[model samples]
Target: MQKILLLSVSAGAGHVRAAEAIRAYANIGDAHLEVLHLDVMQYVTAGFRKIYTDFYIKLVNKAPALWGYLYNSSNDAQADSSIEKLRQKLERMNARALLKEITAFKPDAIICTHFLPAEILSRQLKKEVLNCPVWVQVTDFDLHRMWVHEGMAGYFAANDEVAFRMQAQGIAAEKISVTGIPIMPSFTAVASREQCAAEFGLDGKRTTILLMGGGAGLGSLDAIAARLLAMEGDFQLIAMAGKNEAALAALQALSLRYPGRVLPQGFTDKVERLMACVDLVVTKPGGLTTSECLAMGLPMIVNAPIPGQEERNADFLLEQGVALKAFDAVTLEYRIRYLLDNPSKLAEMSIKARALGRPAAGQQVLDTVLSQHP
Candidate 1:
């Protein structure tokens, strides 16, 4: 059996999600491969892990501007600020335990979904502390400078634009593969509208819309839901307020207020099923969510992408004609109404979305990584 280690961080669900998606593919597609999915944060100190993972959510939610500033600052190699230096020092110090585990695992190849683990492994590889090939998977549509390290065997990107960005950052063009963001195999399963509607107790004849804000539920979902409810249409709403109890409660209350028009779901494993029944989705452009939606061949109306990478994700989706962006609740409502009323436009977007989707991305990435292994 071949040993493979997948390194990911919990800073956001997307990185870990991407790792799991690939892990799943490896498990089912290649029975001879032995895979271990490790959250890199677990090897770090509790405080450091919490600060990087949980605190990140608070930062993006409360002080998005500061988050955006830090994101942009890290992109500049010339601006080696003290904070960046300190962070790197801490990451290296915390990586000692991770290094020990890697040495013991004796993996043939190591795959990284988050940048922190990539940087640590890159430095170790350059120093010859580890000999296994290291593959870095860029989970977002945009490439941050932190993900570009000195010693990487290969780079897997979500799209050609991201691959081009990595190439411009000094990585060899041949080292990059545009695999599309890997999504779980569950997303590849086909579901008919009638099947999902009957299972979820929804009207089969009505146009269904899914409103979601990724896993953290960070957008103005309540406002968007309110706007949606006020519209007059032959539509049903599936509001997936992921892990947001308050948002779920509000959405659930809509069932009483509007009667059968709204269906509220918390963090669910059946998102692929819900998506099958929906005509369109209102969501933020989180790489994982967008990739999943694209895999399902569902068109998107990106309501409010956070100011950094998500904005870039939204830009790519819009440019690809798979999605439309709305700057505010009013525009979100308008787009939904217009798109739903025009089946031709919705079909067009869905066609583009399917064209861009790489449902087998995880399997392709794994094959590339293994093929490069010495």
Candidate 2:
């Protein structure tokens, strides 16, 4: 059996989630393949690991402007600041254990959902010390300079625009594959309003809307929920406050306040099921969540995508006509009401979303990687 090493860093949940999706596909689609999923953060020093994940969360949440500045300013070859150099040094020093694990595993194909491991292996491959092919999966609709490293076997992109951007940055076209961002296979399964009706208490009378914020309550879900509930319409809200206890409590309280109009869910594993029940989703355009929505053929009303990757993801969705971007609560409320009033437009958007979704992208990536093995 060919060994598959699936690597990710826990900078945010999306990278690890992408890796898990691919691993799940590998297990279910090919019994002959041996797979191992490793979070590279586990092998790094605790301080480095903590900083890698925590700094990202705090920076993006508390100091978004500063984060945006860093994101936009560092996306080029010329912008090699001292912090970047120091980060690379820290990674090399702390990830020695990870290198040993990869070298020992003797994986025939190494796939990375995050670019940090890919960068380390790029050096090893260029030195001819690592013989296996290393492929990187870009988990966002945008490409950053860090993900563009020497000696990568190939890259899997979220969409055509990302592929084009990589080429513009000098990555060869042949080295890139426009595979949609992978999600858990469960999202690809066919489900219906009838099927999910029993759980979320859906009815043919009221339009159902799903509200989520990418598993951490990062986006302004409370404000959006309040605005939507305040509006008069024949609609209901499935408020999913993923992993946010306070948000969940508030949403539950709102359910009481608005009786039959609000259905709040905490961190649950049944997001795909919820999508089946809803007419449309209001969410942030994180790559994994958007991919899930697309796979389910559900239309999106995306709001407040952070100024970097999420913004680009929202752009792709809007340009594809699968979603609409809302700048604030009032605009979001307007879009929701407009869509509710126009059922034909919602159906059209769903059709476009399905057209753009690559439900079997995980399997495609695995087959391509193994088939092209050096």
Candidate 3:
């Protein structure tokens, strides 16, 4: 079997989610492929994951400006060394062990969904210890300097804009391919909205809005859902309280009060189905979710995108005329009502969103990796 190790991180859900989608895509047929999904953070200590996760959440919530500044300022070649050193220390325990295992697999190609493992592998290549073609799959529409490395065999970006940015940063133009982020196969192939609603037992007549807060359910989703429900509109709400049992229970209790109008879901693997049925999506603008929404051609009401990467995603969607941004409860409610009331505008946005979709990104990336290695 041709070994293809997929590396990702568990700090947030987007990276691992993207990695899973690619793995699923690669394992569809009699392709002699052995896919291993790894969380690089798991190789590190528990304290390391805690500190990094906490710091990321706090930085995004409490100090967005500082985060933005850091993101913008760190876009240089010089910063790569510091980042690599930090990753080395975090993965010190199993770095060599994992590397040996991968090398033993004698993989034809290695794919990376997260940057940390890519960085480690790049370091190994620099030292002449690793000699495989490394393909970096950038999940976000915007490319940071960290995502661009000197020795990457190929870069799969989300759009032409990101590819252009990579080319500007000294990466060869031929080495960059604009393949939209890989989403679950369901997103690429699913039933129509009416069919999906029938399957979910959702009323097709009502305007359905699906609200999500990534995997951890880390956002003020309750407030936003309440505000939407309070608005006197003909809309049904489905709030996905991802991986947060307390939040799901709280929303479930609220759903009891609203009865048929509100539905709360726990962590589910059926987001593509939900997106297919929903008229509008209200969620934080994580890259993977945003890409999935685009694939489903669902118009979005962005709640709160984190300052650095997600902000870029929101901007890209807005520029494409496929989404709108509403930062607070009142604004979000108004936007939802306005869109729901005007079917023409909603139809137009959805059309634009579908036009921007790239459903074959996973296959495209796979082909690129195969061609380069062959």
The number of the candidate with the highest TM-score is 1
Residue pairs in steric clash, candidate 2? none
lDDT of 3 by residue, 215-291 (tens): 22223666567767888877898889888898888898888788888778888888888887788888788888888
Give the candidate order by descending lDDT: 1, 2, 3
- The model with the greatest lDDT is 1
Clashes by residue pair, model 3: none
Q: Candidate 1, residues 127-235: lDDT per residue as tens digits?
A: 8988888899999999988898888989999988898999899999999998998888888776787898899999888888898863233235665676787888878
Off by over 4 Å in 3: 80-94, 214-219
Candidate 2 lDDT tens digits, 107-207: 99999999899988987888898888899999998998888988898999988888998998788999999888888888777577686777667663468
lDDT of each: 0.86, 0.85, 0.80
Q: In model 2, state the lDDT of residue 209.
A: 91
Per-model TM-score on C-alpha atoms: 0.94, 0.93, 0.92
